[model samples]
Target: MATTAITRFAHEEIKPKIGSRILNSKEELLAGDLGPQIRELLEQSGVLVFPKIDFNDDEQIAFTKTLGTFAPEMQDGTNHKIHKITLDVKENPQSAEYLKGSLYWHIDGTMNDTPILASLLSCKVKATWGGNTGFCNTYAAYDALSDEQKAEYEKLRVIHSVWATVFYYEPEPSLAKIQGMQRIGENELPLVWNHKSGRKSLVLGCTAHRVLDVTPMRSAEILVGLREWATQEEFSYSHDWSVGDLVIWDNTGTMHRAEAYDPTCNRMMHRTKLQGEEPFE
Candidate 1:
């Protein structure tokens, strides 16, 4: 929305409500002052796409540091900070099982005290059929709700757990597996997150288990209805991946998921995350 020299490089309003494509070169994106501008744009546009930016692990890490605190890859023992996202057990044996949970829409790190600020993902290998990533703008979704709906949802609190997402992928798991997922714990989050900027966004995603103090059937009905409303085509974007494409989205204000693909398709993405500054109050 704001115009400047960078406006020439910023091709925004890509969709009705969500994405902006940055046409700048790597040099411009790495410039000292561009970080704040990019962050500002990210707030206005929930998703930003860099076509064929092709940033390696170190370059991606450097870019992430410019935006906010860099969240390193802690699972694998590799020295590199970027985490490879793939379904291939050979590449990410230990973590691939957890990635299956990503098939359902979720806000990253909901189990943590503070959720992640943003996520930067670069496409490495493209899948043959499906692997498109979809993003829904919660801010826009919240703004579209009726006054009665807003007032009702505003007072609700949600119980979120990693198990909520995992169950979507595995409806019936062994008792041991269920217990393992529960160990990740749960947190009570406001159904609507009122940001410091005074903008509010709905926090409905697969990680959301249920509405606290509500009947089970009522909670399911509300959650299912909200998820459908928030993810309608008008408020969402589905990105078809191309090799070397890079995408970054505001994790706090958006919910995202990968479109189902064959496990053998060989799709891989390198990801880096920016640490969050606010809690889900």
Candidate 2:
């Protein structure tokens, strides 16, 4: 029988339950064939932070590909493998307006059955004040639930709508704007996602418009309560960025939101992703 090799990189836990810091050089991370180990770490830790690794666009893209399929970002009717994450219209014109939704807690690709597998963000410019990204480990949150709560939630379903997210920032949207966002569509997902790996996670987020077969008021209460519980200090991590820092989170098992900040303060991030491997089931 062959024995598996032990992982060699240095690591530090960011929190007891949710996050970790990878203490390895950019060169080693980019060159080492550590995808399996890294993916396992991501599943276990939920979030990984690389302090001041300073990877540029090409390097970031290369690093993303090392893990799995590279998910390209669509901009200006073109596919750009690396996306510039900024609220500045000059830098990311097409995506800037849509990014307002990032201010609220949400999972990416809620409109699709399968969201991106993971997101890798490298800091280009740190915010002048309050731009730390917040993440919550849904897996940890679900695991922390009481047996009765888990059993009850496991049977519920939710309606996740792209248009609903628009209302978070724009309470009263114009008919045309509503129609446009509606065209992007919505998906009905389980309140609890049962992963192929046998772990479970909550699928609640801002995009979760309502719980099906439940009263509107009840839906609101349930969703809001679950979100609050999941985001409590124990299961969440808020990253204070330093220029050149990189952060990665498992999109399938976590909810993330951008902390409020000055859009014009020139806070910038470069983002890359791994294509989704499992659909929400």
Candidate 3:
């Protein structure tokens, strides 16, 4: 397995194939011209953990821009770079219900042709129990597939829909709720994303509604089977959160899910995203 080559900051690999922990002071990270180095490290290690760096919203936004284009969270005509990650209706009324689907393994922005490059999530209120974010390196997973498996998968396509994700969390939903999710739409994407960087990653996730040109049973078998394979312990990492912890993961190369936690705990996180530079092909 390729190892992370980040020499500027004192760092340790979290796992052989997936994560890296950066041991650097918050000031150095913000003041230095480390964008290129950090980006390289991010690609090498799909997930980067900054233990208790404790960045507030302004600092997080500033840090996000240093790395790449900052994707502001545009909601209800309000443009804000920091998004509140929470399930509490009173705190995040707009996305509380939607976040329930986050419990399942999935990639974000599957409906969009180009998903965000990376997401920076800093914990503000840690969960009392559970709620460790789980991540799987899809790029590593794809590389480990047998040549025969890779060859066969390369020819397949998938239909991904937001409504499918809703159904996973809300088995029996009202027609109105279904209509809302349906309006977010579905996208047809290749089973294997042939990235510009010449690396391939599996696009399987909960949003993967069905495999095109395959029987329903076969599609289920393929999707579920691949998800299991990609998430094997060797290629996955589950991060335990602290109040000041911040994490960034390559959205284009990883599949992630939220571990179960108390709904009323009010675990909060502030997030910022980097705009995607390439489309999933």
For candidate 1, the per-residue lDDT at 185 reads 92
Note the residue pairs that clash in candidate 2.
Answer: none
lDDT string, candidate 1, 50-121, tens digits? 999888877888888989888777775555588889999999888889999888888898887688899999
Query: lDDT of each structure?
Result: 0.88, 0.93, 0.92
Better structure of 1 and 3 per TM-score: 3
Tell me the spans in candidate 2 whose CA falls farther than 4 Å from its real position. Answer: 1-7
User: With candidate 3 superimposed using the best TM-score fit, by how many Å does residue 132's alpha carbon deviate from the native?
Assistant: 0.5
lDDT of 3 by residue, 127-243 (tens): 999999999999999999999999999999999998988878778899998898899988999999999989999998999999999999999999999999999999999999998
Candidate 1 regions exceeding 4 Å error are: 1-9, 76-80
TM-score of each: 0.94, 0.96, 0.96
TM match of model 2 to true structure: 0.96
RMSD of each: 3.4, 2.5, 4.4
Worst 10 residues of 1 by lDDT: 3-12
Error of 1 at 41 (Å): 1.0
